[model samples]
Target: MVETTRRYVLAKRPEGKPDRDTFELEETGVSDPRHGEVLVRTLYLSVDPYMRGRMRDRESYAEPWDVGDPMQGGVVGEVVESEHERWSEGDRVVGNLYWSEYAVVDGDDLSRVDARAENVTLSSYLGVLGMPGRTAYFGTLEVAEPDPGETVVVSGAAGAVGSTVGQIAKLAGARVVGFAGSDEKVEFLEDDLGFDAGINYKTTDDYRAALDDAAPDGVDAYFDNVGGPITDAVFTRLNVDARVAICGQIALYNEEGVPTGPRKLPQLIATRAKVEGLLVRDFSPRFREATEQLHEWVANGDVEYRESVVEGFENAPDAFLGLFEGENIGKQVVKVAEPSE
Candidate 1:
């Protein structure tokens, strides 16, 4: 029988930026599954930038977590006990299980995951096969539709969504330019990830000049993950009829207060560029179709993925903090609790 459980609780809401002190470790007894629920033992907990928005008490696409509550995020788990007919014991699933040893979830929230599907690991379904993957897929194809031989610029080029977006753009015959935080990340994209060009944003003092040197014809599509000045730079380089798919604004997440804006409204109007924010959840209706296509590409070796796994349940908080520092190479995950042998 399951006994005690440990969870990382939101100890204190961050005034400006979050630190280790924001989370507190707490233990409780494992909860029983009710009639339409199942008990899942957490395996891999996903750490993403979107969680930063949830930390704020402000309203957005999702609800904010109350102070002193368990911090929630995407998780892949194994069903240990089940009172639901849809999920039997030993079935693996992915859902919003939070930062806990175990969670009793309603059957509706959990989706069955096959570890060996198309030779893809279960952890991948939480990444390239899941939300981040979908964000790259639909956001690029639907939001930022590019013609063959056009130029595509992607910010946060080494992260999960950015990396995938670059590859997808390349597959569609676009010349891809990537903007990343480090020389190492730039090298990874250019040499390893097959990007046509990569600019180290941190080292480069003038981003607009860098873009000018890299893409002389200007950018046709911009897959933006880090907003702010990088996006501002892209705006000045947009080709006629260019599209900017806004995915995330991670650049401003750490700031305590909103900074004064030197508004880019004039640039937007001058370029006549279409800028649309994309949420992967909005494309959930076509998720299965996209997953199937992605799976085929992966199996044929046309698509690739990378992961940074942190071992142990207790290390979840640190794994999360690593995102802000760019400590992770790709998608970051915490191996919270292992599967039953």
Candidate 2:
């Protein structure tokens, strides 16, 4: 059995965008699981934009990571040793585990993954069938609630959550428009994901004009993942009684100070738009329901997903930093190790 583990720790709080120096890799002795716990060997780790919030000294939906402490996020792993009856050796599971190669976690904190399930990969548990998927399902369907024939625009449309939101809106019989960072992402949204229109925000000189040209009927629902000038443009085109789901604000996640942008409340008031922030954890009680539906959608070809996987555990920090750079078309994950099966 492996006796040592390598983990990434928060070295310092990032002022604006986090760099490689923000994380420090440390090697430590692996400990055996005590009663009601299991030793997990990480197979894959998720790198999300939300983790940036944790890098700050302030509090948010996720607790701030203290400097010198191990950074944590969703991890899919195999149970190498178990002191809990519910878990056995070689069992595949997923949980909010540390960035280490191995971790001693309580059985209750982990959810068993059925590796035998058809078409399901271990990495999918950290992405499409996991938190990002759940966030898209609830945020679009529950928060945005786009009615049939309505025009729904999604910011960050090539991303994990944003892509899912656009597809869900399309499934609900609404016209879906998307704004992505690159031309290739715009193509993916339009050609592969069945979005009605896709705009390359990187290429567009006028966001409002591009949006107006695509969504002539106006945006009845907006699923915002990146909040910045693009979002400001979206606010201008909102139709009456529009619904906006504020799922993420990736655009401002790295700013050293609060960025001042165009005031949008006046537009919201004029349009009577309702904007509500979303956190997937709030829908935890219905996770199974969402997961089952998402699984079905993926299985039946009703939904599609992509993954940008970094090859090694050592590259986890790089994969995370890539989020702000829009390097991934969908979910960004680090392949730590293969399952022991």
Candidate 3:
């Protein structure tokens, strides 16, 4: 086993957007397990949009990060040493493991990965069976409330949450229209995932026209992941008493200046639409319920998912920055260390 542990620290808070310079890699001594804690070797680390907000000093749903501290996110790791009653060496667990090669976390903070799926990797607990998937399952079903035969429009439709939202919407008997950045992703939605329609937002200059063609009957529910001009366009086409679930705003994440687009506050009144922002962590109690359903769906072959993994702990910062470039098709994960299993 490696003696020295590698980690990524927040070098400086970004004035606007985060870049490679924002993170600094450092090596430190491997920590020993304290009483009631376990030492873990990280396998997979999640890179999510919510982490972007945590990086900022501003107030948000989660707390801000201190400069020079290692960044934090969900991770899957194997136990190397344990002083806790609930865990032992060789047990696999998932928890808030900071960007590091090894971690020492409280036994209560980690959960054992009990169920095994044939052909499915353990890192999936950080994606599909994890927070992002739960966000899609609950955020769309409970918040968006798409009824049968209704038309649902989703943005960031090829990402982990968006893709799961679209597929779940389809199974619930809704016509799904998705927006993706690449034709390959658009095709994946339409052909592979069985979406009713898909638009390559990058190729199309007019979002309104593309949505008009995809959802001719009007959008009954909009699951927004990437908010911007496209969200403005989506709001205009909402049917009477439509529902809008605001998941995330990836487009505005790296903004250094003012934002431009027709404000949709007036449209909410015009269409009698209810727009609500959703945070996955808020529904943590129902995570097991959502993941069970999603896992069953996956086992029964009712739903499918994809992952874009960047190899190595050192490359996490670049993989995180790549989210803005539309470099990932589904879940973007960073493989920090190999699985011992």
Candidate 4:
């Protein structure tokens, strides 16, 4: 009997926040792997804020997804069938694959996972040891460049990339402050992640004042994950020669038109600040190095991670939609299926 696969496809372009209508689920038969290919059974699928931009019809850093096409993201899976020299049956791997239960992919597109790694989970490859980890690694240490005793601020502090950025800043000896949406997230940042302060942005009426209270020395580095009012406030507190890494602009992702916010160029000019937008793919050549360091940090408990998993492949769309709702803490991933022994 031929194996079947279930997947989610883009139904419509979202004008604002996406709804259930934005995705359509489909069922299809999986094709046998050709030479130099493998048939993978997805174990976990990553849901990230950046996927929202890809839903639009326009081009950006990543190609836009076409309507009625299967959605794609980071997936960790087990090879159930293989016709490739480098991969074999039962081998666990990670790659950019469709939001499906199974997919046939080229051998070169998949990276083998080390099942022997101590205390590592398969989902870790989609979160802390994957794209988000690499993004935080280079964005903070390379782009933001926070120094010891300097104040570093991260927006969207509880999410995947932001959480890692704040913790990495702490490791660099910088005083880290984070802005999150809820009291629980604030607690996680300050108490769990060792941030100097975590402001509940939802409850704060005056963002600038709240940021001022948190960073009395002014922000020396800003790792911006959610841009808008929170970012506008952080710019006001930038110290001389401040560095800003624009990792994500989740606040504006769902907007119909370009979202407007407070003018920040004047502040940048006055502070002589440097701001650079970062994409993890830009540092692809050094992914192994970053992954190695992140794995070490995670293994030694020097860096901690949290995941908000939505169980079942059927709920993958729900998991993706939840990103704008702030439904996740460290990383949001969907558990598709259990690996076969």
Candidate 5:
């Protein structure tokens, strides 16, 4: 009997924050693999802040999802059927795939997971052991370039990328300060993650004052995830020659037009900050090296991770929407299905 899958498609472009009406769920038959392709049964789905950019019908670093087409993100799955040399039945793989229960993907598009890390959970392939981990790995060490004793600040520091950035900065011996949304996240950063300080941006009345207290010596390295006023404030506190990694501007992702705020260029002029945007794919060649190191750190208990999992495939859209609301701490992922075998 032919199998079927439930999937979501883009029904309408959202004006601000996307609502449930923006996605249309459908049930369709799963397809057979042709040449050099594998049929995968998805086990986990990664929901990230960047996916918000894909929803808009505009030019972006990633391709925009066409209306009436299946949405896409990161997925970890078991390859149940393959007509490819690289994979066989029961092999677990990860790839940039569709928002569907089953996906037929080109063999080259999928990467085989290291079975040696058997102790790691499969959902981790969508979080810590996956893109978010790799993103934090490179963005912090390579781009931010924190030095021992230097002060480092991470905005959106309670989420997957931000949390990892803080831990990695700490490993480098930098004084890590994180900006999160809640008192609980602040506790997670300072208490559990060993950050020097954590500021609850939502509760704080003055950002510069908060920075003065948390990073008294000034910010030497910054991993910026949420832009807007938080960024505006950090710019004012940048130490000379401070390095900045532009990771995400999630704070403004949903705004309808060019929102105006404090001008940041003059601050850069006074501080001479080195700011550069980062994309994880740019370091794709070094992914293995970084992954190995991250795995080792995780195993040694030097680096820790957290996940706010939204169970079931039906809630994937909600999971994605939650990124904008500061609704999750650490990596947010969806549990799609369990391995059938």
Candidate 6:
């Protein structure tokens, strides 16, 4: 058995956007599992924008990573050794774990991978059937309740959560418009995801102008994944009684300090919009229910998803760094190793 593994640690917190220097890869001894814990080999690991917030030392929803301590994120792996009654060797499972080749995790902290379809990649459990999927599910259906025929706008529409939100809102009979960073992403939203319209925010000189043309009647619901000018533009066009769900703020995640932008408070008052922040952890108890629905939708072709998989465990930091650059079209993950099973 392998007695040691390589893992990434927080080498230094960043002054701005994180880069390779933010992490240090080092060899560490594999931990032995005590009672109710298991040792597993990581097969895949997720890279998400929200993780950038964890790198900060200030208050945030996710706990900060201590300098020089091992970094952790979502992963899917095969159990290699078990001291728990719930798992056996070779069982595939998923959990929020260390960014290493192997991890020693409490059995209660992990769950068996319930593949919703044949030939499904184990990595899908970290994407469509995982955190990002559930985030889109609840953030769209529950928080931004778009009624049939209403115009729903989603920013960051080419991303994992944003794409899912657009599709799900479409399923609810809403007309969906999306804003994406590139022309290719705009095409993906319009051609592949069935969004009613898509604007290339990177090229658009005026976001509000484009939004006005697309949503002539104004936005009735919004799922905002990118917060900055796009959100400010949407706020101006929100209809009375509009509902807005804040799923992410990738646009400002790397800003050294709070960024100054257009004031949007008065727009909310003018529109009487309900703006709510979506912290997926708040709905953890209902995760299974949400995942099941997302799985079924994915299985039956009612929903579509994309994944950008980086090839190796060594490139995990690169995959994460790419998130801030808008380099991924969907869920960004690193393929650490194939499951032994």
lDDT of each: 0.86, 0.92, 0.89, 0.92, 0.90, 0.91
Candidate 1 lDDT over 25-143, as tens digits, reads 99988768899999998989998998888788889897888889898888999999999999999998998776898888898899988767555887887788788888899988999
Window of ten residues with lowest summed lDDT in model 3: 113-122
Q: Could you tell me the lDDT of residue 240 within candidate 1?
A: 74
Clashing pairs in 5: none
TM-score of 3: 0.97
Estimated TM-score per prediction? 0.96, 0.98, 0.97, 0.98, 0.97, 0.98
- Global Cα RMSD, each model: 1.4, 1.0, 1.4, 1.0, 1.3, 1.1
- Worst 10 contiguous positions by lDDT, candidate 6: 114-123
Give, for candidate 2, the lowest lDDT window spanning 10 residues: 112-121
Residue 19 displacement in candidate 1 (angstroms)? 0.1
Off by over 4 Å in 2: 115-118
Q: Which portions of model 1 show Cα errors greater than 4 Å?
A: 117-119
C-alpha RMSD (angstroms) for model 2: 1.0
lDDT of 2 by residue, 1-341 (tens): 76999999999999888999999999999888899999999999998998999988888989999999899999999999999999999999999999999999999999977644555678888887999999999999999998899999999999999999999999999999999999899999999999999999988999999988999999999999999999999999999999999999999998888789988899988899999999889999999999999888887778888899999999999999999999999899999998774
lDDT of each residue in 219-317, candidate 5, tens digit only: 999999999999999999999999999999998998989699988898888888999999999999999888888888887778888899999999998
After aligning candidate 4 to the native by TM-score, how far in Å is the CA of 147 from where it should be? 1.0
Compared with the true structure, model 2 gives a TM-score of 0.98
Worst 10-residue lDDT window for candidate 4 reads: 112-121
For model 1, state the Cα shift of residue 234 in Å. Answer: 0.9
